[model samples]
Target: MTPGPAGTTVPAAPDAPALLRGSGLRVTDQRVAVLEVLRGAPHADADDVVRAVRERLGRVSVQAVYDVLAALGRARLVRRIEPAGSPARFELRVGDNHHHLVCRACGEVRDVDCAVGAAPCLVPGASGGPVDGFVVDEAEVIYWGTCAACAATPALLATAPDA
Candidate 1:
């Protein structure tokens, strides 16, 4: 299903008691509210998250949002990413070895599956002096480009003779 505009009301936050019991979270109004915000606005920055949560739970403090984000990120429930020149953002997609494509002009992010279907892209150029045995869990690859929206802009196209 498509997401709504910022601050748009979605379903009420998931059942607090059941969610907490399943995930082992403490189950507070703030935590549920924070998760709901992330669910609606994946890759939202801290400030945006605060705004969204406040819209749902009126009077939610910025500090409360920060704390909840920290807790969720630590538990691997949320994925936190900070692309260069952009504020850190949080999303609910986790566990999969997904890469990202960040729009250089707009800083928008979208997930991409493993380069060839599974783990490890190209083998590391050099294994930092070969340790005894280090297992590689996941590999992250980011593709930077001008998104369709940015590429379609006349000003941007005019600047690039190649395009």
Candidate 2:
């Protein structure tokens, strides 16, 4: 596991085409390129993905990239996470109850392990919150804070008060 920007460890990205095949997704150039981009740069938005894919594969369209993302998302090969006030980002981390820490200052995102217990976080205190819930199965938690890089800069601190 490679340590991400924030202490969250990022799982090594699996082989491009192989991963797609495992997900039962038709292995295509665009699909491979999109996965490669996300593997190298997790939490990338659609625009960032489009630029990277085009860099690797001559030309690609925004709509096409979105289509690939949609396919990957449906196959559970990729995950779409939308942080409020920010564009939805994509990552390869799936089939787990991992969380994320989004930098409020610069929108940097990092993967975080399940806060308490195992997947789903169904047990009380397992989610770092009140245990009372109606058949909890998945936990989507985002810890918003100033990333180290932004905190050091000081000038870019978000104007919005800390939550």
Residue 40 in model 1: lDDT: 68
State each model's CA lDDT, in order: 0.73, 0.85
Which clashing pairs does model 1 show? none
| Residue-by-residue lDDT tens digits, candidate 1, 1-163 | 2233332223334554565557778888888887777876777999999998888889988888999899888887778888777898997767666677887766778876667755665445377332456666677677888778878896875664334
Per-residue alpha-carbon lDDT of candidate 2 for residues 1-163, written as tens digits (9 for 90 to 100): 6676556666776699999889888899999999999988889999999999999998888999999999999998899999989999999888788988888878888888898888775454655564565566688999898877888886787463452
Winning model by lDDT:
2
RMSD of every prediction: 5.8, 3.5
| Residue clash pairs of candidate 2 | none
Which residue segments of model 2 deviate by more than 4 Å? 1-5, 122-134, 158-163
Number of colliding residue pairs in model 1: 0
Error of 2 at 135 (Å): 3.9
